[model samples]
Target: MMTHIVSKATYRTHMIALFMCLTFLWPCAICLYCTDFSRNVDHYCSFCNAFIGTYE
Candidate 1:
């Protein structure tokens, strides 16, 4: 019984970590890629343009 409870808690912690990574990390990655591509092509993608002067 104690082992089962511990396992559940561990699983919940892992899930929270996964959720945080997906939520926060993916956006930064996308922004970086969008900016890099825009710089190379001399055209700002909509995603990069939308974020301009935002929260800066």
Candidate 2:
């Protein structure tokens, strides 16, 4: 019989990496989807057409 085991430290590291990736990617995806590049107007999201913010 063969057995495989994952160490606690390794598991924790993987979990932390996954959480960081999720936190970073989720917002980036939403931003990309909501952003409107067709119109060169105010910085407003296309989905809700809400002004996000100004660059300068």
**Per-candidate RMSD, Å:** 21.9, 22.3
Model 1 C-alpha lDDT per residue in residues 1-56, reported as the tens digit of each score: 11111111234344545665688865544444334322222222354343222111
List clashing residue pairs in candidate 1: none
Best by lDDT: 2
Candidate 2: what lDDT? 0.42
Q: What TM-score does prediction 2 earn?
A: 0.28
lDDT of 1 at 56: 12
How would you encode candidate 2's per-residue C-alpha lDDT over 1-56 as one tens digit per residue?
A: 22232222234344545665688765444333344322133355656666565432
What lDDT is reached at residue 20 by model 2?
54
Each prediction's whole-model lDDT (CA): 0.36, 0.42
- Listed per model in order, the count of residue pairs whose N, CA or C atoms clash below 3 Å is 0, 0
lDDT for 43 in candidate 2 is 57
Assess the local accuracy of residue 18 in candidate 2 as a C-alpha lDDT between 0 and 100: 61
RMSD (Cα, Å) of model 2: 22.3
